[model samples]
Target: MAWTTIIPATALHDLIGQGAPVLVLDCEFDLGDPARGRSVYRAGHIPGARYVHLDDDMSARPDGSNGRHPLPDPAALAARLRALGLHRGQQVVAYDGNGGFYAARLWWMLRWLGHEAVAVLDGGRQAWLAEGFVLESDDPAPVAEGDFTIAPALVGGVVSADEVLANIARGDLLVVDARDPARFAGAPHPLDTVSGHIPGARNRFLRDNFDATGKFKLPAELAREFAMVLGETPPDKAVMQCGSGVTACANALAMEIAGLKGAKLYPGSWSEWTSDPARPVATGQA
Candidate 1:
């Protein structure tokens, strides 16, 4: 079966042991210290897991207006995935120290690229450690060339900043900001110059999707929580965003796990939304 949403550490262990064709990725990252991702990956990671850099591999260089972590060119990102040994049919298990924050970005990207076999490691590295899985410090062996290519998206793709702006006036789309409550409340954030959110967007702190154990909440629980925010809007009518579009994917992932699929992502998110001074920004509670 394709592991589309999230996979437990024990399940991943069994999959690896079965010698299935898989690409395990370590997506641990720190927004403050960019190099720390690779540093920690080199220190220790899942055996045979390759490292994926958010800034270098998953995103394009920021051009002042394209947000902090702009989505990379699809073809370029496909080529990078191929280089990382992700083939058309291979299963991808992505993990991170952060509660699937960075890992879910890769999961969403793969789904957007039409690969349905990608999953984020539930509970991340801590779960793996708790399961008594030994991490390896040695460098992983080089992988053979992969034939992965981009296909039509299997999940909701992206919604542009223009669409989001128009939605503010249209009052048709549901915009959900996945940043923390404080950040969503227009608190000063070091990552972005602007402090507010899209005029009609609602705050849904991504961390709230998790339980006390750092694992995702059960599907039924997630459904009830999102129901309070969604009201009568269908999942397809919603757009998810965060400071720079990273954590937004986590919210999107949670929605999928809640069986509330089809919510599109605002790739530029708050960063891109705030780039233009002309765009309206709303501060305080929604």
Candidate 2:
């Protein structure tokens, strides 16, 4: 539970006048343009930054019958992080502009609700405007509504669908797909409803977790790039998944910012394991 992947200009110079409860979440998302990411954060953002809205503040509206961003209710996300001021000893600093992909889903939903001083932002806002920093073209001063709480370990980072078919019929489980490499090789999953992955999954390609300036790659270089899909397996039975569990919580938050041990999402992942046509889809390679 020790993680940090920051670098929005060294976390905006560790926040100018310094305000250490340090929050800056802005998870700008699009997934086929959902109001074009709060209209690009109302045309400007980052000084005190706020805007969440991954389909209304990191998801929970999917009534087309569940699954897309379906991991919201932790007392309604601690009352939406105490009306966006967050607490329980704050220090969150999520970000997004396609580099932390929805800011690693609010830095893995604020450390799965237990709040471990979240951090992601490594190259989000495109590396904080390529490190020139200081953006905030106005729009920020709106806080002070906080008091956030919720902390039952957000149900300990969910992994359902009958616990992934009883951990793939008790082979003792190890799925881990985090999409790409042509949709895990079955290719063509521009969203889902075909194109492979799932059966004994193992592609692990969330942009190899990040580097080449999209940040986040030191934690022994992300444990030597996820030790090739986490071989020698030990990261809590490893589950993860993608295409709908949002970058598989950005590869389980870059394997807990590479101290590598937190794996367990799959929240209706691969849209409920490819909506079970009697589940079982694997194509090409893995």
Candidate 3:
């Protein structure tokens, strides 16, 4: 599948060990201080891993309050992929230092542009280290650029503020907030201007989707956990959100691993949603 959350370490190790035509990308990013992720990547990262800083590379300038993390131009992204030797049919593995904050973004973006052979590293680099996988500061082996084509983006996969505004009472579609407990509970948000969430949105911190070690829980484990919350709500109808739309992708990515489908992103999230006073805000817990 194009949107797998966890790939096997043994499989990756064997492929990497034998020098396969695979590319590994390190997507370490800290939302509190974006530059901090680059510093960590510079100090030492998974050997042969190319760093993709979230601010500088992954995210474009916020397009007003309605479009945070707007998709970068496909041609520009293709150029970067070419430099990284990510061509069509090439397997790409992405990982973040903690959980999959930024890695999931790259993975989903790649799939959005029609590249299917990409996945987020399970348990992240920490798990690899714990499993005795080798680490190196040197860059990865050079790869021959394959033919990667850019298809038109499926814009329907993205939810808009207008959609939320119009469908506040629609019971068929559910909006999921993937921020921390404090932020989701509207207790003085840390990043957004307002300290509230979208009315009718459900809270599921992105952190809950992972284990204490920052690795994703087993697929079965995740399925049971989400089932308790989702009940009979098919995952496909879920729309994910968070501050500025980063961690929400983590939740969206986890759903794919759990065999649920659709679950698109509300990229503007609370940051854009609350930028204007005209939008309705829901405060406090449900």
Candidate 4:
């Protein structure tokens, strides 16, 4: 079976060294400094890992309405992946300096493009370093392009801002916000002009999914925690959101890893939600 949600650093190392055809991508990124990710990757990264920039590869230019990091064009992203030698039957592992924050974006993007054999490196580059794994500063030779095709029909992984509003109005869907408690409570507007969360959304900070060491919590623990938050709501009836839909994928990834699937992403998230003056914004916990 393909590693679909998350992979450990040891497993990733073994895969790249001896397992089936694998494509490792370094997705290190800093939201404050976009160029720093590439600079860091160039400095040192996992062997045979190609760098994927969040702005250039994973997301499109912000249009002031589509949130900060809108999903890239499917065909364009597929072409880029193909150029990176991504093809059928290849397991793609994405990692970053942060604990799968940016890495999960690429993981979700691959699934959105119809490739299910992709995963985020659990604990990411931090865990790799902690494991005493060797890093490679030299760039590898160019890889031959692979025949990766775009499957637009598989684009059922997202929900629109309007859909989110409708869900809130209907009071049927469980909208989960991945932002920190402070940001969700409408205080300290660091990134956005407006602070607060969707009126009916519940807060489930992404950091809560990880342990003190920064690794994700056990699958059973995650499932139980989500179960408490979800109550009677099914996984399919839930939607995940964050600042600009980037870190939201982290929550979605955690859900999938915990065997709770079918959660849709509100790609517009708080950034796009607050873009309109008419939208209602709620402060404090849910």
Clashes (backbone N, CA, C under 3 Å), per candidate, total: 0, 0, 1, 0
Model 1 segments beyond 4 Å from truth?
A: none
The alpha-carbon lDDT assigned to residue 244 of candidate 4 equals 91
Residue-wise C-alpha lDDT for candidate 4, range 59-127, written one tens digit per residue: 889889888888888889999999999997689999998889999989888988888789888898889
Per-residue accuracy of model 1 over 106-137 as CA lDDT, tens digit each? 99999999898999999999999999998999
Compute each candidate's TM-score over C-alphas.
0.98, 0.34, 0.90, 0.96
Clashing pairs in 3: 48-140
Candidate 4 C-alpha error for residue 63, in Å: 1.2
When 2 and 3 are scored with TM-score, the better candidate is 3
By TM-score, the candidates rank as 1, 4, 3, 2
Per-residue CA lDDT of candidate 3, range 165-221, in tens? 777877666888888878877788557788878888888888898887777777888
Number of the top-ranking candidate, with TM-score as the measure: 1
Looking at model 1, residue 185 earns an lDDT score of 83
- Tell how far residue 154 is off in model 2, in angstroms: 31
Which scores better on TM-score, 1 or 2? 1
Q: Which residue window of length 10 is worst by lDDT in model 2?
A: 1-10
